[model samples]
Target: MSIELPQRPFFLAPLDRENSGVDFLGLRQANLDMMGEMIPSINNVTSYIRPFSLLSWIYWKFHDLCTEAGIEEATSDDLRLFRERIEVLFTWGASLHETAERIPGISATPPPDQDGVKPLTFDAWGRVQSSTSLIAALWYGPASKTVTGLGFLSPVPGRGGFFRVSRAGAALAQALDNKLREDGERYNRLLGTLDPVEANESDAIALWSLWSPETVEHEEMASFSSALTSEEAIGSNDTLLSRRSTTFALARHHLQEVGAEQSIPKIRRGMCFSVRPDGSNYDVPTTLEECRRKWLTLQMRQLQRLALETLLSWCEDQILRYDVVDTSAMAERFKKSWALTEYGLGEARNLAELIFKLDTKSNSVEDFIRSVNTNDLPDPFSIMAEITEKFRQRDPGFAVPCFFGLLQCASFAGAENAPPNMVQLGSAPRLSLRVLRHRLVGLGDVTVAEAFEYILEAMVISQHFSTAVNRFDGRNQRLRLAIEETGLTALVSSAWVPTVTEDRLAMLLTLSAQSDLVSKNFDGEFFSNGGIKNESI
Candidate 1:
């Protein structure tokens, strides 16, 4: 007999797994060592800002402010302050709003037509950073800005058309598309999905099922209709013809219910209900069944609006301001246990990557949508060869700008009998580190929290960073010089990779570690080579 294991909570599995590990050249090794003497509780502590919890915060936030009250009814100033939040939500939907929120100051929406500081200043590289990202251009920059960042999107701005229900009626239109009714003069005024006159509800449903497009032309139903309409013998001799005519009688009754003035038409069509009124027909609005179904239609409309921007805008803007994207461990862990999206955002991202590599820049937004529906992606490896040949004269530096995607693809490495051409990333590069410390020039020891905060603040500033206004105008020069010496390379890929080379990653890892806010305790035993191999924690 096989053993069965109980399913684990989605949140707990990752929380426990990432708590400790044998990291070779990564920050974990060095961080473990430094915190060993400072505090024993670091690795053992719980965190509010772990990867899974943080990604799902938006969902919980919606439940708190939007879904309960309903999206159409939402008055969240965060949703109302800037229209970009609505646009981003529609593009990325509920799943990707977490990433949007993390781009510092994105939630700081000033009310429409009012002054607000621009979110996202440039990064160390000066462009292609979070502040200057393609999303930011469309979300915050001027209406005329052109974006080439990933290449799949066009700037579509304007708010409040997202609601889908029409004033004419949703159920009638939906039923029409299903081929349940005829497009005669009666048109949308006669609904075909509902029960027909002179037939019990179940009988109307049976008549509808028997008359569908798939079975409408079936030999059996066609023969039945032929026998009923035939000139010779169906009158008193054919019992089947008599039953078939009885079955189609309800359709004829329904034409009368809609007040058709002509003589009863042949009972060739299926069951239908009339929205149009005639003196012979009873009032539909007063009928209990008709009134209930319309009320149900209203209920569905409310449910649909819950996920739209109108309801989402009612939240307290404060919940959208949670900004621990890169300073925390979130940057390193999102890939393993990601929240999935319904916006086709992944396929959109894939198509964006494919479009960026195309020789001609003439593709349209329609092309992207068509490719998404068909999933007809051009082979990237073949595209790489074609692009390289085209750029041979230019030598456009893929080595720096897109080295991440250009690196060896190993998407199939874990398969038991992996294809010979596919392989995982090779061994970690070797690096060295030393214990790090800093002090104020005239004062005493600088705290770890202050150090991490300084780097984060530096990233936010367009010019020099400062504790107060003019405290460290020179810090930008020092940080810029360090990044320049480390020689930050560029990378854009379907999956996340360190934008910098391994050497540069180590350089920042060492620098960033000395500033870690949570690096207060370490279990150094995990750092030993034998301890990593032989011991399990």
Candidate 2:
């Protein structure tokens, strides 16, 4: 069995560009014919297997080659090698396609398993992983002309094709510029309204306003209309009320730490005297009077809470239905569902809910605020603080929650975190796997079977701890008993086994046990009953 690659047009009317609009149907047909002609040459016994399976083998082979060569940089030579490999693979792929078409049942062949090798299943969704790896490789590898050649067939012009290559280059330049612009815009927006006069005076007032619920309430209805009108009439050009609002907002930010050094005598005395004891006079005030003025100025220049609140309300209204939280009238409906409390997960769920809600109706800012309790939910600053604290703690459980919250919030604001891998999984598991694999392959520190034993032992221990306090039903007694009886601690402490291997095994077993328990408790037909099939996974 063999397969052929799909043909593409060599030249087509510039799809969405200027000055080139000629139909290239003949070129496309010709390309396809060329691909067909090349297919048979690459066909072999392996053509009977699935195209994806063959692709996996090719990819793994490349990985092994790269490892052997220690080729982290995509130099010209590396690129040449890659191109050759890709060309060969493409030819092979085309043959497989042709064979599959010729032999109807070719895809049904059981994929081969190499000696002592685990049968590798090609994930249909592996495209995402591949894309991720591609990005990583490009980022980490040295610069190369190979990228240019690689992009020759890319849909985006300038990126690959001669005509479009400049466009791609320009696009990259534009992207960099856009990023700069965005960062500039954000910086300006955050500090945009800052007036030296206001910043020096009103900062304290703003801080007080944000932290004090009483002040917030008072300001909420404190005649913003009057304030705006009065500020406008002052011919100040800069609105005092708007500035004040900004100050308050900044004060509320988790990153901003105010009044932390107020108690130091020297600092306090200097603040009060406007002069140091050594007689160095300062331009700024030293008394409460001066402090009040500075605080007032800051408050005046700061962003208004009402405006921000309104903006948030508007965003909420726009995306409430997609909220992942409990939306049904019956609490029982979500009794079995995961109840995430960490800010990130909650925020993610909330944002999802908001999105769903927006689809149902044209939500207004007022409606959004009225519908939800803002006080109960942590503010953005608080959420950031939570994430930071969790990260500092280096607790995976805590980190996951924070990561989820940050991801959701950033998404809601139409921003994405740097890279998925940064938050994909913890470093511990990845590092552990790498270390163990290196020891096994490079050092021959342990037999393959011994390695497996160590890994399983670690997994069992982790499983015990994770299930010890199961949140699902608060009933993980059996799991706890199993761990205690299994001598998990003793297994973990075994001299010959690596800690990581033990941890890995424990985590796996815990997951398995949890799944089993969920299955036993839930209706047999339910997806959570442990027989659930996931297409994506």
Candidate 3:
């Protein structure tokens, strides 16, 4: 038997999440009902990921690789190797150079003569030639996680340190800017006339007024973008970020200090990476305030929600879990039947709800191209906004539209994709299988494992024998049980195993001494006789 070394420069596993099942799904705590339309979960840049933190990470990683890039021994292989090292450091917070100084064969010093030739000679992240290219390659938000076309992130041209905000990004920024101005003016007019900003107004308008965007930077632009975030959002972010590595934070903060302590802040080699436009000679077309980005996000969400209604109508026609996807009602017109709270959004989410929408942003089906030629065109801003949004979805994994469940409905909005289930499932599972197991054990006195085993054993026995049980009502089932002391043994021999009513099955399990399966559950009550099956688990 033989073993081969895996081709990895940083031989450390990515860190396990600090909080494994944190919050159990953000929507449960939100004002919105988790059972209603899809929840708002920013897949990335959730409050915990501050621009400062990201900037800090990029800055130090560059410093670590700058020297290596300048060395003569650098090769293409060094790019991949050191890129992995730098990113691994960012993800797991491990130092490769420190480890190399400690470990065995990897830590050994190459002979003095070969030091300038071999990148693997272990002088540090030694082989990497161009730090900028490495930064660009790794900067596109986890190539493995993005589900977008050309993700919103397109690193700045020469210095790959900062990514340019795409035109679509600019539109989202502009869209939010427009909405903020509109809402702010509307609120002023109503308040000046002393007429109340009534409930009947658009939720966007009402929500805009409610947040008092006046408190944020731009007084006139009081949109979801300009408004100070809810206390809840702030608290959630602080709690999460507080748990990050203290060492990582200190080092990052140290690198960002100014004055004699100021080591370029975020500027290096005459190049700058900054969120604010600091006259550092680094420029990008647009840097929409955080508020604008959030605004564009909500606008897209509004459309996605509308598309969802169309999708529900679709799944109904296709007979694809129609009962779950479309819960019909005479009066509850806006009710989303895609899931019930009891089913907890059920299997609808796992139906790969967002991939098709994501695909549209890139390919824009033939239907969209045809529709574009029609005379009833929307304003150019809107059309461009939609177009740009689609382009932003190029990242294959965490496309914002999909992650937020705001799947692009371009073809979908005009009644969108007939998205087929991708051959392989990529969406992260929304529900925990363990949690599902626990819920399935619903009301049982026995552990989930025990009940599962008992069911398996019962199934095995039923395969071998059949028996009969006669009821007091003159019903003669092919199974026997109830008072039978053999209990579940009746499951093996009696026809009752196959022919008995659910009530009798409950009685059999209730009477059995070892198997603690109970019948008090909703299904048990619905399917079985009143008394016996009523025994709650």
Global lDDT of each candidate: 0.22, 0.24, 0.25
Error of 1 at 512 (Å): 17
lDDT of 3 at 183: 59
TM-score of each: 0.15, 0.17, 0.20
Candidate 2, residue 152: lDDT? 10
The better candidate by TM-score, 2 or 3, is 3
The true-versus-predicted C-alpha distance at residue 129 of model 3, in Å, is 18
Give the Cα error of residue 121 in candidate 3, in Å. Answer: 15
Number of the predicted model whose TM-score against the real structure is largest: 3
Pick the winner on TM-score between candidates 1 and 3. Answer: 3
Q: Cα RMSD (Å) between model 1 and the true structure?
A: 33.0
The weakest ten consecutive residues by lDDT in model 1 span 525-534
Query: How displaced is residue 302 in candidate 2, in Å?
Result: 15
Better of 1 and 3 by lDDT: 3
lDDT of 2 by residue, 196-299 (tens): 11111132232222222111121111211121112222212133333322222222110112212122222212322233333444343121232222222111
Cα lDDT tens digits, model 1, 1-537, are 344543873221211111111221232322222222111111221111111111122222333444444565433343322223222222222222333122323243222221331221122113332342322322222111123111111232443311122211122123223333343322222222111112122332332342221222222222222322222221222333232222222222333344332211111111212222332223222222222222222221111111111111111111122222232232112222222321222332232232233212213322322332243432223323333442333322211111111211111121222211111111111111101101111112333233223322222221111212232232211111111232321111111111111111111111112222101113210010110011111
Model 3: worst 10 consecutive residues (lDDT sum): 494-503
How accurate locally is residue 443 in candidate 3, as Cα lDDT from 0 to 100? 26
Q: Supply the TM-score for candidate 2.
A: 0.17
